[model samples]
Target: MSDSTAAWVAAGVRSVIGAHTQAQDAGRTDDVVALYTPDAVLELPGMDPIEGHDALREAFKSWAPTQPQLHLVTNTVVTPGAEGEATATSDVAFLQRGESGWAVHLVGHYEDTLRRHEGGWRLHRRSTTFQ
Candidate 1:
């Protein structure tokens, strides 16, 4: 495949992470659902893999109301096939209001399986690893 095509695919997957981080920063949970595929699944170490759009959206929405500020950092590690799917990983950091001061937290390694969609690329699955 051409370098530009590869880059574009990589960028598309990377943007899903961007969208989530941006929305989190803006306290906008409504759009979080669109960050993943309709059948997307999320696996965070201690938690079960959250499946489907409705549940995932709801989970994020729960946090959205709290208005946490977040930042995401990602790297598209590879484009394995011509199907426009890729693997990427990200780091997410945020701060939330607390009794005394803002508490800072970091979630790392969002290993993702991304697929090409009508609009672009969407996250198919995410496996989170604690740092």
Candidate 2:
């Protein structure tokens, strides 16, 4: 693809990563869900799929109290698609405040489908698996 197209895809993926970290750090569950499309779905291990914004909101609200101190995304690959759609995958690490300091609480990856909206790219679906 052209350099300009590649840069746009990178920017879109970066926006998702930024929103995730910012919302988690601030404990803004609403903001977290806002990064998703209204009909977005989230799938994580051992839990039924959370579909739509309302369910996504509740899921994030329940998680916010855990206060995961850090959200890190790395090794991202974004593939732009036709008609303003895209897909991305990234390695993620979640850190928590330990008695000593920040400790690795979880390691995982996110597989996402994103679509451009009025505001920019928004996640249409996200599947997360922790290891």
lDDT, candidate 2, 1-131, per-residue tens: 79898798879777886887788677899888878889999999999999999999888888885544887888888888877788998999988886788899889999999988776889989999999
Residue range 3-118, candidate 1, lDDT tens digits: 99887777676667788778767767667778788999988888878999888977786766453455556453655465767887566555666677767676567778888877
Q: Which ten-residue region of model 2 has the weakest summed lDDT?
A: 62-71
Model 2 scores a C-alpha lDDT of 0.86
- The best candidate in terms of lDDT: 2
- Predicted candidate 2: what Cα RMSD to the true structure? 1.5
lDDT by candidate, in order shown: 0.73, 0.86
Clashes of each: 0, 0
Off by over 4 Å in 2: 66-68
